[model samples]
Target: LGSVLLLLALYVLQGVPLGLAGSVPLILQSRSASYTEQAFFSLVFWPFSLKLLWAPLVDAVYVRRFGRRKSWLVPTQYVLGLFMIGLSRRVDALLGDGQGRGPDVVALTATFFLFEFLAATQDIAVDGWALTMLSRENVGYASTCNSVGQTAGYFLGNVLFLALESPSFCNKYLRFQPQPRGIVTLSDFLFFWGAVFLITTTLVALLKKENKELTPTKEETKGITDTYKLLFSIIKMPAVLTFCLLILTAKVGFSAADAVTGLKLVEEGVPKEHLALLAVPMVPVQIILPLIISKYTAGPQPLNTFYKAMPFRLLFGLEFAFLVWWTPKVKHEGGFPVYYYVVVLLSYALHQVTLYSMYVAIMAFNAKVSDPLIGGTYMTLLNTVSNLGGNWPSTVALWLVDPLTVKECVGAQEQACGTAAAAELCTKAGGSCVTTLDGYYVESVVCVILGFAWWFLFGPKLKKLQDEGQSSWKCKRTN
Candidate 1:
């Protein structure tokens, strides 16, 4: 019970920063360009995909007296708290008001990038600690703790914060008296969580002691060089290399629907707070779906679940495009109709089901195929590939949205307004840059087409790899 609680707490802390980062793009949706918002997100999230590069150092180097995990975890948490508190001071200026003032994307990106880097380091330590913290029989619970804690933390940081920060939401739901703004601001939320991080980490440091028996000995722990060598050797295996390629390319199909849809909704006049609230129902679904999916994923061909889930997820990209196109039509003078919200909720729920199924399936496949001799490192490598698969595609989709979208200035001059400056000039010259084409829709069509192509091309190969003998994936150790 204690072990579970500790792991949950650590993972929750790790997740809050991620949730906070996720919320920023939504908050800035109106103030910044779509590409800018995604660029910020992509930069902040890069550490997660790239953390495997430094995972070896995190494992191999630690102060014996301070405890291996704590050596990194304690200082990392402290720095994270300090960074958050510092960011809270400038967040208002960084975000800017939804009016004329624009966000300082460069500063926001730099600040959050460092913050996420710390959070990623903490993740490495907590993940390492979870193994030793539990009995071998109960070690399986670590992933469960991770999934639940991170989801809950993400909810609190993103959904709850966004809802509470909206004056309209607070007025309608929680407040007895009307106010100009929501009960809490972004600054206050950051400061409060930063303090919580500091306090909780301090308590863990002083009260909880690391068990000496659980600590890795000099013989057991690999040096950084050995760890990297092992990682490369694992990559060198034909089967593992093929699998890595599969992991890295898998999410291109789902990227637009998964990464850009919500932001695009906000762009199309959906209220940010309402969109955040829309995710409230999804929190439990996100937490519970993995558990349910794990059952199906435990079979020999876990990738089968992934394969089945792909087309549905890709299909939802079209559904999402249709929903965004329909949103403005359903919106009355007052607000969106009840039926519209219902349709959106239902659609999003279905999408989440497919998403989690794929996620759990891939993770299960990774566990099943991993080389137990270098279990942790091997799993980390595969997970890194999986994360990168999602990250890079989302980034590319976001980057291409502006370029693919078509707009024209409608007035006396009748010129193309391809850039923001051109749009501004059009506005100044008694003209409007009306969007004749939405990049999101264009991107959605291309993504779905690409998704189906990849599916047909790679589906057979995935099944073949899944059936390959285990010896093909195992790497021989070097002296």
Candidate 2:
């Protein structure tokens, strides 16, 4: 229960920025209330998504210092809690004077990014511990609990909380007339989430559970010099490289497709209020998707089953289909035209179902192939690569969102950015936004193409590796 709650809290906090930024453009902001503004808000996601970069550190340093689960959890929970409270206070300052977009977005997103990093680091520990602590017999059951918690967190975090227009801020900004300030700023309503995480951490600290009997002792600990050292050694292992490469490539295209689909809603002029409706499908997703994915396995299966599962094959087709089919309408009428959000949600739901199913299938397969005694480290290596997978799209997306310079947009502002900040920045300055949108589209298309290409190029090797992953470990077989 503690682990599940802790995971819930972490997942809940993860959506704070999404809810906040989605609501931002509608607020009485100086910037154009355009899709361009939404793109700016999207920039906040890079930090959270790129968390794969420092994942090894979570295992090597953060976990090593305090213990895998606790190190990341303790400081992260407190910081997120305190930081959110600070934001609530900061809002009094920003909205107090009605601060500029430059100063305001920067301040909020910086703290947001830091909190995301903490959240990301903590995820590694949480996920790792999930793998380690649950007796092999109970893993499928434990995964069900974790998924439920995580799904609830996303729905509550993004849907329920974000959808509520800040009455207080509205009451203040718009006066007694009750002009709704569509959504609050990044620092707006996160204090509640801070409480959630703080409570989770407190509960986790209080819970007493069985420890890993197989975990190595003092002298074994002395072997790890640092996070980076541990990270490098892990990556260098033979199948580990194969895992990392596969990991890095696997998600990039799919994520790009996913990102654009959401952007399509905003770009097509769908309201954040409409986006709130997207959370509805998450109910089924929370309840059914994980189980659907786990259905094929019984104490792990053969790699041939993985190959037959068509993990990559199905994802390739579904992603492409999702991107093409879920086109968003620009505006709404008497009744809500939240259809775009709904379709997109379904797309995402299916995408996640396939992705998790494939991911677990692969993991079980890897467990079968690798020496069972080294499960902890090999699993850690898989994580490191998964982190790498997360990084590529984030860096690309950030670049796309950052906007080119004022010079490139309309005239020269001299003070703005270069390609280094993301050429998309130029388009964000008002006149050039469409051009940036084109760039984002192009990037997504490129990612999709790459995914297809990867499917063809790496297909055979992945088939072999996945096949090996299915073969039961001697240890697992005995059990």
Candidate 3:
């Protein structure tokens, strides 16, 4: 429990930046950011999408005195906290002050990139710590901490932060007019969270003790080349190769659909507050569903569980489009009905269960097949490949949304036509610009088709390869 708590704190600090990143689209949309600008901001998360590049540094370097993972973990937290403090001072200027004073989006994105880089580094260190600290018996518990704690941290970073900044909370408690400024601005929240991070860092350093079951042998410490060779050797295996390919293509359809839906929701005038509110109920769902998945996937047929879950995962991608299509029916001349929020909340819960089930199942499979000889490197490589598959497609989808959307701006406020510069260009050209999601719909349809093909074509083959690999490894171990 102490280890879980420490990991939870570490994940929460990492999540704060992620949450802030989630808020950027809506916050900047109010100030008239274009789809491209918002997409660029989203792209700043590239660090996380590509952290495999620097993951080796965490493994390679550490102080002998403080502890291997701890040395990296403690200092990274302090650096992240400091970055937050610095970011609070600059964010308003970067995101712009709402009176037509345009902020430097490039500069702001650079700061956010730095923040994400640190957070990604922290993730590497935390993962290393978890690998080293958890025992074979407690490995399942560590996975639980990872899913629940990390999701909780992300909720605090993304949903809770938005809720705090919403008009409803401000109006009720802060006695402010019903406006989105709420009681605390984004900068103030950053400053407070920065302090919280430092405090948590101190507690983790003091309380957690490193597990000493595995010591790094000379072979393990040979060089970075050995790690690479070990990783490559695993990839050369037929089962591991198929696993990588499956992970690479599996989520592209779903990721592409999810990318554009959030932007569409923002365009439909749903407040960040409402989205955050709906997300609140999903947090426990996020934590609980993974536990349920862990329980069911604990059996020998975990691969079978994944195969069964894949269809539900693919179907959930279509749900976002269906929800968007049905929005008008639910709203129907009145404001959004309570029923709409309830439906969204329920859908989100279902999404969590389906998505996390597949995720935990994959993690279990990776764990099962991994060679203890390579320590954490084998699983990390698999995870890195899996993330690349999801992230790059999502990045491409962001750019696609811009071209697909039709823009309109005539007699509209400067902040109303997506961006101030776009408004200027549209008004000067004497043509109204209106944006539409025709492209997203097309892309989503294609994604769904691709999802079906990937499942039917490759799913069984990959499972057979996995079964063969696991059986081979067990025989080798017993000999």
Candidate 4:
């Protein structure tokens, strides 16, 4: 019970940084261009994809006296706390709050990129630790802890923060007298979490002792160079290479809906705070679904659950596009009718089901297939491929939004507002850039079509890979 709770705490801390980074897009949607916001997200998330490069080092190089996991975890958390505190002092200025100047996109990217790098390092340590932290029979619970803890932390950082940060939301629900700003500012939140990180790290360092019995013998423990070689050998296997290709391409179909839908809804006039709040109902859902999904994924054919969930998720993309189209119609002078919220909540709930189903299935599959000899490096490699699959496509979708959109300047300047600069010029010239077509819808259609195509081409391969004997994925170590 204590180990589970500790693992949960570490994962929650890991998740908060991700939640904070994810919230930046919502905060900047009104202030920054879509492409710029996407670029920032792309850079911040690069660390997760690239962290696999250092996973072998993280797995192999540690002070035996200090504890392998704690050697990395303790220092990484300390650095993370200090980094957050330093960033809190300058974040407001960097975001251009109350300033006429636009956000410093490059600077924000660099800062958060480092922030995520620290978090990713922490993730590698914790993931490796989880394998040893539990009894073999109970090791499966690590996925549950990860899903629940991370979801809870993300809720606190994104949804709850957004709601509390909105003056209107606070005034409507939580306050007797309205203030000009929400109760918590981003800086205050950052500073508070930074303190939490420091305190938590101190407690863990003082109280928690890693089980030395789990440590491999001197002869069994691979050096950093040997660990990397093992990683490369694992990748060279035909089955493993095929799996990596599948992981890299599987998310292409869901990218537009997953990355752009919420932003598009915000663009279409759903308040960001309200949109954040919409996720509130899913908190419990996110926590519970993983436990339930784990049962199905524990079978020999874990990818079967993932394969079945894919089409439903793809279908939700179209549903989200429809919701974006319908939002304006439901929106009124004051606010949306109650039924609009119901529809959205119901739709989103269904989407969450499919999303979590796929997520848990893939994670379980990763855990099942990972080579125990280099557990951290192997699992991180698979996770990196999966994350890259989602990241690159989302980045591409965001980049293409402006280009695929069709608009015209109507009124004083009657011209095609094909670019953001043209649209800005149109607004300055007393003309409005009227959208003849929304890029989101077009992208959604293209993504769904591509998703189905992928399923047709690669669906059988996924099943076959899952059915392959475990020995096929094992590294063939040569002395």
Candidate 5:
């Protein structure tokens, strides 16, 4: 339990930076950034998607004295902290004025790129560490850590920041509390989280010690060559191959829509404060569902539990799509009912719970199968594949939806008519204005079809494979 808690803490650190960085797109949107710029901001997470590139190196190299995972973990955390602190100082310069024309987008994104790289590297180490720290029977708990800690971190990093930036928050708090200009941006928030990273580092350094025996065999640690060899061997296994396929397809139905909807809401003029306020109900869901799902899936047939839950989870994407369609009507007609917001908020919370539960289940699955010899590389590969498969559609949406919908315009007409007329002209040029739901309609149909096909075709075979492989993998470990 203590080990799981520690792993959870580390994951929270990982989540915080990502959450903070993830806000860039929304921030850009609020500042009237272009669709291209917003999409580019969203793509800043590419490092996380591609962390497998360096994961092998993390596996191959480690200081024996400090510990296999710890050697990397400790340094990465400190560097992450330092980077956050540095980012805090530069937030003003990077973010520029809140208008769309702020700092150089390229440079700001580069800094974000660097931050995500460190965070991704830390994730590789942490995933490796979880496998070694926990016994085979309890390894599934790593999923709980990933789900809960990451969710909490995202709430803090992304949602909390959004709330703070909202007019309501500013009107309520800033009016009374005159903060310094230095504290205006996410600088103070970044610094605070950086302190959290350092504190976690200290705890691990002082209170916990790694078991020498848990280190990969000296042969496994020879270098990158050996890491690749082990990774290749693992990939060749039938179960691992199936697992890879499962991850690649899993998020297609639900995850993609969830990714695009927030931007849709922002584009629709839903105030960040209202969205954040509504999101407060989700905090408990984030913390609670992981515990429930982790416990349920920790049983012998984890994949079966996941399979059973698929139909229900698949509905969330469509529900979210409906919310996107309905929200604007409610806002415009009745002034945005509190009940309407509550219903949408709760629906999203439930969706997040089930969706992320499945996600956690799979991460637990990866943790279970990964060979400790190349733990970092193997696990990182699985997660990277999952993220890539899932993120591909979302990234596409970031770029694709921009041109599909007309929200702004350019030309000499803007000089007299202003931004609104410019937008109308742009829409006129595009031939018609697209509602927020237009993008989601396409996603919903595709996702629903894919969801059913996966369940009917591939799910049962994968479950059987998972069940059979567990016994064999255990025997191999025992030997």
Candidate 6:
């Protein structure tokens, strides 16, 4: 059990490295004033969403002669570690394309894509392994633990490394170059990515081994197509569709909040060091939230448990509030990093806990939706579609920010008028006593709410456990 947790921890940790690597471009795009440069810069993260396209193959194939979860998992983990190491080695070269605009985005994406493929493959194997390892009594614990691992990695991986790009610090460190404005652009650093690939590859080869399963006989391996068959079955189910939609909608408002706050902090001179320290709370939230969820679901109050997890009404209400009010009132005059950070911290902690409630609800919903025979396939398909949905909105959000020259128009203004309210500065900036990245938040909230409504109204809901359409009964997300 300990080894499984550790291996899974390693596996989940890969996401952060990958997410952080991806975040570099997002940081550059959000902060850099040039729309064209950011557009080119954004190209490096393109492969993240595209990853789900190949998720099926990752499920079906293994490196070992026999087919088992760890066979493929072992190899994939090392590849990701090496990919990060390589990027680290080339950190200087990888960043700061300046206005030159990365001509090498394709190559960079190619390498990032390589890293993502292995990382995704490992994700599949680990998820598969997790199911095999859990008993019904312990499944919630296992899922929650798994969530903890993935979520922990997500926060740590991104925050620890993403802070490296702090403009003030990078501005100083990057002075060595002809146009050293930032540390790494990602697009221009493909050659060095090989190091990450090499390191991650070596780690996997060193650490993992297959524990279960068998080599298929010639007849069993004849079609060698567990992937295609499973995929086909998943699409046939209506429950899978609803589940996927729910996952996509779960944290959109939360995501918008995060995007807005990050911009606000950087604008207010909340140094990365301060931001880094302030961010400590998020780590515990990720670790603890999932466990809270697992424990909540383990009890006997089925509907109550489901409601706490679903909180659909609460989530929607928050979306409306975020869109029309909450974010628009951001105050930064006193410059209380403690206050500002606390608001964000509390907001995210609630967000994390509530969101995992949805995950618990999702698992329940999927189980209620389908039986075991097609259940695995159904879940995988839902995960794939939900992941894809995440991309659609995320890309739209990122793309919107890029072209609008958000940091210049918004970031600078935000920096300038954080607490001018009832003071000369506030009157100087014109309208309110204070100004904020509220506009950005408002824009994102509106988009997310609209999307949520569309999905809520037009997207399918659970009527019957297996019902497919309008005839289905109205309901909640139990899993």
Q: Against the hidden reference, what TM-scores do the models get?
A: 0.96, 0.67, 0.85, 0.91, 0.76, 0.64
For all candidates, the clash counts are: 0, 13, 10, 0, 0, 26
Task: Give lDDT tens digits, candidate 2, residues 145-194.
Answer: 55555555556656655455544434644565765354554454677666
Off by over 4 Å in 2: 1-75, 91-106, 121-142, 166-178, 182-188, 195-223, 226-231, 297-346, 401-437, 467-479
Candidate 5: tens digits of C-alpha lDDT, residues 283-377: 77766777778887776667776787788888877887787778777776534678877787778877777776777777777677766654355
What C-alpha lDDT values do all the predictions have? 0.87, 0.53, 0.73, 0.86, 0.72, 0.50
Q: Per-residue error at 382 for model 1, in Å?
A: 0.8
In terms of lDDT, model 6 sits at 0.50
Q: Which candidate is the best by TM-score?
A: 1
Pick by lDDT: 1 or 6, better one: 1
Give the C-alpha miss distance for residue 224 in model 1, angstroms. Answer: 0.6
Over 230-293, each residue of candidate 3 has an lDDT whose tens digit, in order, gives 6667677766777788888878768656677766666666666777678776666765776778
How far residue 45's Cα lies from its native spot in candidate 6, in Å, is 6.7
TM-score of 3: 0.85
| Alpha-carbon lDDT of model 5 | 0.72
What's the residue-level lDDT of 411 in candidate 5? 38
Instruction: Estimate, for each residue in 68-136, the C-alpha lDDT of model 6 and write its tens digit.
Output: 665666566655655566665554444444555433444545655566666666666666666555544
List where candidate 3 sits over 4 angstroms from the true fold. 1-5, 101-103, 131-141, 172-180, 202-222, 299-301, 328-334, 407-425, 429-431, 435-437, 471-479
Ranking by TM-score: 1, 4, 3, 5, 2, 6
Q: Runs in model 4 with CA error above 4 Å?
A: 1-4, 131-142, 218-220, 371-376, 414-416
Cα-lDDT of candidate 1: 0.87
Cα shift from native, residue 61, model 1 (Å): 0.9
Which candidate, 3 or 6, would have the higher TM-score against the true structure? 3
Q: Which ranking of candidates, highest lDDT first?
A: 1, 4, 3, 5, 2, 6
